[model samples]
Target: MPLSFFSGGGETGDLVRSYDWTSTSLGAAESWPQSLRTTVSTLLLSPVPIVLLWGEDGIMIYNDAYSVFAGGRHPRLLGSKVREGWPEVADFNDNVMRVGLAGGTLAYKDQELTLYRHGRPEQVWMNLDYSPVLDEEGEPAGVLCILAETTERVAAERRRAEAEAAVRESEGRFRALVNASSDVVYRMSPDWTEMRRLDGRGFLADTEEPSVLWIERYIFPEDRPRVRAAIDEAVGTRRAFELEHRVRRMDGSAGWTFSRAIPVLDGGGRVVEWFGAASDITERRNAEAALAELNATLEVRVAERTAELQRAEEALRQSQKLEAIGQLTGGVAHDFNNLLTVIKSSTDLLKRPDLAPERRERYVAAISDTVDRAARLTGQLLAFARRQALKPEVFAVCDSVRALFDMIGTLTGSRIRIMTRLPPAPCFVSADPSQFDTALVNMAVNARDAMDGEGELTISVGAVDQIPALRAHPAVPGAFVAVSIADTGSGIPRDRLEQIFEPFFTTKGVGQGTGLGLSQVIGFAKQSGGEVMVESEVGRGTTFTLYLPRVVDGVRPSDDSAHEPLMDGHGMCVLVVEDNPDVGTFAVQTLSDLGYRTVLAATAEEALTELATDAARFDVVFSDVVMPGMNGIDLAREIRRQHHDLPVLLASGYSHVLAQNGTCGFELLQKPYSVEQLSRLLRKVATWQRRARIMSQ
Candidate 1:
């Protein structure tokens, strides 16, 4: 062994002298190359945090400054490889060692990486300067690095940014308030059902006293529905209300006003009333109307000018549009996710041959409910443009695909390999949520068949601007999420490619396949405003891509209600009023099954007749909102009038009346509800009513 020569490395120098370098990849210190010895001696005396990563193994040697930076790692890290030493950043260090040993130098300013200091992981930023250390033969042997920590500097910058953001937000809110102000001021109830006060400023009729029919009195006949819709939307969200619509003027002629309203919240943050103002925009509207007519006639001339400008702005606008996505959720985004877990789990459990009937029924109900919910749970999602059986939801493509991995593995079997090429950021799409899963599963199964139970399948998801003319179909240009499933297997023939999507088209012999898989994929794609594409090379592989229209502003994430087990209801009698005989029967039977006394009424009039018989016996009236005569809302109002103490619950799938008027301050359950949802809501509403009665007393 060489004599003790690490005299200048402080504590590290003595540690290096006593270290058993023979156990390490670097071997004995006595047999070390002359250049490494010189490099080590030079670093040992330096105050800066310098480390020498020697040889292919990146054997680490550092000065006292670097030792202090290592914290508790110190002496143990002395002879260890750089990768094994900082295992958290092993990949990063591997790349560094690779470049340095190959005689290449690297420098990174404010390099951010997580490091384990003091035996716990901490994010750190460092300015790293790396260069190769040469041997006596003038060949690169190892990497030498100088590191300066900048974590604190980065944190300080972040703090400054947060403070700046708060100032900007305050300014923005102030600007909006100032801009939305107008001349004629008004106040309305939180529900906008009653106009509490209005100063029309001589433009229109003033309402000094509260009027329940203010909308009919103030808004023009043609504009009443639009006005009510806007007001209801604002009330529902408790947000600022803004509309520019026609209203009845004092002179009885139709005029326009830009009405802006803000919810006035109490100290507890509940909206107690709406404070609003209106600016007469009739003159501005007439001028805009004339301008619109002129523009309509000059479309051809302006189109050319617009086209030229668009060409210049295309790239910037495209990038800006993508980056602006930070600004915006559709519930049920055919972007639908999170529905598969229940189905998969329930189905797996159902495979047991000896499960008890009640237990089996519960599992069956879970699956049944999940499937039904796939159709029912619309949750502010875009309705299918074409009225179809599709329950389109906006869902994240990457996340949905990830959710299917376990199921996909079961379908593909152990012999086949599964891989994914997905972008780090989530890509979203609009399509039927249930059908999305079916299409992917169909493709995966097809891939398995093509591979004969062995080989590889890759699912790739990404955003694309345009799809080239695929098969016989014309090219489609739009933002789309492309989910490509590629399989390493014998591929389809060129001539057969066009016919693959045809229903009942199959190459399998006998009854091996139904041939509806690819058909479903194509059908779903077309319905979703997207397309399915196929690429194949004989004896090589096949790639099937299902393109879906991408949606950037996905549904806002809402916490799903915790579905506690279905509870047995007390003997709370329900008067089930459904217009449909079938639905009424189902509700009555379901209520009875769940330990509730049920009385069936096929019409709103009939329900009232039943209620008139013994209103005291019926604890609640569970009535459908949309019926032929009187309707559910009118019936609810009537019930409230006659039986002032009895509770009423409304249900509907798509009631334009409910959509415009909201729940009318009554409890409402949406259609296609499962046993759990129905049961839960019933118990909840009943309990609330009981508590309310007690509070009132």
Candidate 2:
């Protein structure tokens, strides 16, 4: 049965007294059926915080549940006013009554209500709903309420909102930082189909296009696949990524870009996206290219300079070799000349009235012929060795070429025809006349040999403002005197052209030629600031072109012959030391013939013994550089110990060894000398002695 139809004993206060059970025949009837009474009573009395009120009057019938909810309000308080029953919540009850009486359902979804129930004080959030009861006339009466507490759910919701706000704020800061950077910052999906990017320059802007569209349009076509792969790798491994690629700009130009990225991962360790920045590096790349090109150019220049240095070193080596040859030749000539002096003196002594006329004449003629041969040999040696120091004077090439015509006639032996083409005007060059003559003779001799003694040789001298391809001759461009020697002889082979200037490299057969001729000519020309060029073909002829730098001054005459006069030593006791018996006897004889009283010492010990035995005798000591026991220089020193003022002359076959000995206060004489040179050296020594005596005084 519904609670509205239930009646207990008799209708109490505010009850509808017209109801049949409450008013008809039993105002206070207890004769109701026990089940009905029990059912009605239970409906009105069971507990669950239910309260029945009769307007502002009181609780009409409060259940055990309502008494428990009220925390000590008794059921005996029924029919009492609600303020007397629960004074503490009088204001709450009045507000609820007003809402219910106005016919509105007052619902609280989550409302916190505080109450002191049985001294257990606490707050409970409840979902409360109130519904009003009606009288028989349909007037609003008491209200019924239903409530449920949800404090935990409300608190949980508030905590979740706070945490979300914090995460959003942190993400906003990160986005700001990416936008403020100079590089283009971006994020991408693992497949790279979707992109999120932050424009570094546009962080401050209020709005801009999405990063995804920007990358899709701007990524260079060629680099897109590679960039995607890089991003995918970073995502899969959750590692950092770095790559360089080209970006196609909006204007269709490509820019080199360097990108660096780090992968962002979720809690499951799966890649979510990639965060990266790409910087434009086109300028740096261009600079590196330019630097590479410059370095290559510098390398080429250094190689060229090194080649030039090597050439210069070769030239210096050649000069030193020639100098060495000269020294050797000069030594031999000195020794030979000394022997010649002895022979000549002996012949002169034999020519005296003591001999038969026919025999004397025969000796004279023989000596004369022998002297001529020796002189010729000396001259050839000097020329080949390049030892005869030139006395260079400014001379015209035209005059030199003209003067060499007669010499050419004699040297060529009429087998080769000589033609001269002289320059119309004078062309000056600094050179020795004899050297120029010798150079001409050599060229003519070579030509004659090339022609097999029967071809025409043309010698042409001309002034050139500039040489023909002279700059290509490994020399600089300048004015030159071109003396071209053209021969119609058997031509030189093309392969042999460069070798012509190399000493001892000759095409002529052994014993017929010494290959120093052209080499000497080249040396002389270079020393004179000129260069030599040769053009040859196998069957055709050869032309040796000499380009000597031009000079301004004309020919200046110089003394060609300043021969030393024969000097007889003035009874100066001299010491001669040598290890070779033939050389020793020859030197002693030569000195004896020169009127010097001589003493012979074959070694340093002998020289010292001779000096000790005859302390005040010798005025000069002459010795060869190398010997068996003691050398010449040491011998000279020992001789000087006894004769302090004595002049010492050191002779050597190899002149370079003499340079190392540091000859101070001593004179040096290369061997193989002429009688005249011996006489001159003796006179010089006598003069130096006389000067020394004066200085002592």
Candidate 3:
């Protein structure tokens, strides 16, 4: 049989074909049993994010799409136990596996989960589906999982809900303010004796029926006498009655109001009735009394009043700045809408069964392109927000900057003068070099625009012992490398300086800038254990300095460019030891896919057990540096003490023992390694092991 089911989805499909299933619970790839093989093939070929859990342990096998979904735990999570893979959500997965293996199905929409994908707890929402993958015996064997992340959609919906609530609240407040302005209307007989029905509109008690003793009911007794005098004077003159006096308000409080009435005169020169309006003047009256009292000591209170006004002004400014949140969401929604439009249109067109094949391909291509754009947009957002998924390596900042000079020069227009200043020695820092390069390029492009394609832009690097405080954060004293970019152009305004780092906030004209560049810069800097500082003098120039903690020792980049071509494992046995269940699973699976025989051990003790079984059979020991009992360094030392010719390669994101005692002269690979990185490192280490054994002979 061709076994064509394992061929062609993408890199993931290729992995499935190359993987050695004999090392796993599923047995050998060629002998996996029809049902299991078919399920594995479906997992590899699916465009959607799907995974297959084989056997009781729920060993994981995910497609490329799911690799993206796995976040920082992708390659390493491939062959790990599902429960051990996501320890933060172990209970959740345990329930899933239990139900699934029982031949039951489970589904959850927008199920919230907190996972430590990048060494930090992140709240995520997912639409999950799980069903059993039956074996040839028609019994429950493994689980099939389909997942869709809805975190961004949830966030957008929340933002929209908040925005709508704000609008409704604003409308309600406006209506209330208009009502509270304190106005009313009423009609009175021309003689000013009886009053017609009155509408209080909140100023005083309403009069549903005409009343004769309106003054007694609606006005204060003492004020009524004065009101009567003013009314009589106006009525006798057949003119408007106007008087400001105290009244019985609706709440039964004696409050001041300004009341006015106008007499309606007949054409025959006789008055008919009076109509009037009133306003609550309680606050104004109280203010006038306070003003007179304060005037006696105005000089003494002037300074205090000024200070209060200043504080109020500052509060108003802060409130205004918070309104930028709407702009940020609006920008994201706008970009997502554009991407969705393309997908929507393409799918709609594709629904026509009789559509031409050529047009069908075109529409499909369009959809694929839109999805890619959407993925890039999502990555950009992640970079700006958390940047939790970081792959750090030790590299010299000065060397990296020098390598990017040509690219930076190209980004800033030819008319601009690009110059560089570097220290005598290489300034080393442990960080994600790709993100570092991206941040530098973004700053360079920003500089190019600031200069309007013509000005001097200087890039400099130096070692610093401390970082001066940036914004409100306290000054940090440590070994740091300062990479500063200075531009001689129109400087940023003091007012706009604080907002420049805000997502989607831009001073550039519309269609000019997305405003995500600086946000990414700040995100990368902060996530890399550093900070970015900006100093701009209006009309003079601007300087942006990024400070990252220096890598003190054991600073060396992986020699990925070794003089060896990519090679297959060719059945060389390897021992894999990792306490992080997820990473351990992925490591074993990845090496097996590379055609090596793998034996997985979750701890160093287990690894020793496997080594003791047949120490000489294993060509290399691949282990994680940070484990629970007996760290990778001690394990390596123990292995060296017994099996002196065995090669042990360790991996980690960070380890206290490794940092304190050093790599112990053993090779080390960083965490979040790619298939290629793992492959090359293993091949190199295995080659050393072979050479050592040959020398022993």
Expressed as tens digits, the lDDT of each residue in 203-294 for candidate 1 is: 76664477888788888888888988998899889989999988877688888999899998889999998988777899999999999999
Name the TM-score of candidate 1: 0.36
True lDDT of residue 464, candidate 3? 92
lDDT of 3 by residue, 517-613 (tens): 8888888788788999999998888999999989775368566556556679999998999887788788888888889999899999999998898
Which predicted model would earn the best lDDT? 3
Instruction: Identify the runs in model 1 with alpha carbons over 4 angstroms from their true place.
Output: 1-388, 471-473, 508-514, 553-556, 567-586, 593-597, 601-674, 680-697
Per-residue lDDT for 563 in model 3?
55
Please provide, for model 2 over 256-280, each residue's C-alpha lDDT reduced to its tens digit, 9 standing for 90 to 100: 7788877677999776777777787
Count steric clashes of candidate 3: 3
lDDT of each: 0.81, 0.67, 0.82
Candidate 3: lDDT over CA atoms?
0.82
What's the best-to-worst order under TM-score? 2, 3, 1
